[model samples]
Target: MNYLVCVLLIGVGATAVMDLWAIARKRLFGIPSLDYGLVGRWFAYLARGRFRHDAIATTPPIRGERLIGWTLHYLIGIAFATILLGIWGLTWVRHPTIWPALIVGIGTVAAPFLVMQPGMGAGIAASRTPRPAVARLQSLITHGIFGLGLYAAGWMTSFFYTP
Candidate 1:
């Protein structure tokens, strides 16, 4: 299989797994998942030359914000997959290891902690939230789960692609 095809499959599959975890988390723990619509809104504002928001939830809704956010979410996943491939090369893709995938997945939390949260006005690492510790833990767990998803997806990809 083409390398690009492998990347796309692994990325999409991993993201889907993460989405499944979000649903399970919400249903099992009565905890809500990140609202990707807000992500879309943030991106929309960024496109308009605005970077920070006092509270993205209060921000005016933009047309197609949900679609934009969902699209960006998957694209970000794909980008991360690219990063993994870039670092590890095709040899890793052929072998599909867990540590590298987990490292990249967990490392992704920095994006939200430094950029997305601050831009959305949640404060760094959700310090501004009512339950900062819980939020942080949740973020860590979710990202870890995403890492597992990456590993799982990598295995799935390896099954179909020898190279």
Candidate 2:
């Protein structure tokens, strides 16, 4: 398979899996998923040179913020997928191991904890949330799921192209 096509397939497939998990969690546990619209708003402001917000929800909504946020979310997933491939090489994609995918998936929490959370005024790892520990745990779990998605997507891709 083409390198770029493989990346898109794995990244998008993994992100879709994570989204499905979020939907399931919301229905099963009543835990709300992060609003990608807010992420979009943050990015909008980010483009205009704003980095931090007292509370992103309170911030003004930008046009097409929802779409922008969702796109960014998937793009970030793709970037992480790229990172996995970069570290492990295309050979790993053919084999589809769980460890590297999980490592990258779990490690992705850093982006939200350090950058997204802080920039959006949730504090590091959601420290400012009403239930910081719970929020942290949720983030960890979600990212872990993303890792599993990565592995699953890798396996699915492997089925399509040999070598």
Q: Please give, for residues 72-153, the per-residue lDDT of candidate 2 as tens digits.
A: 9999999999998889988988898999999999999999999999999999889899999999999999999999999999
TM-score of 1: 0.97
lDDT, candidate 1, 60-88, per-residue tens: 99999999999999998888888888899
Clashing pairs in 1: none
Best candidate per lDDT, number? 2
Write down the lDDT of every candidate, Cα atoms only: 0.90, 0.94
Model 2's TM-score against the true structure: 0.98
Residue 106 CA error for candidate 2 (Å)?
0.4
lDDT of 2 at 92: 83
What RMSD, rounded to one decimal, does every model reach?
Answer: 0.8, 0.7
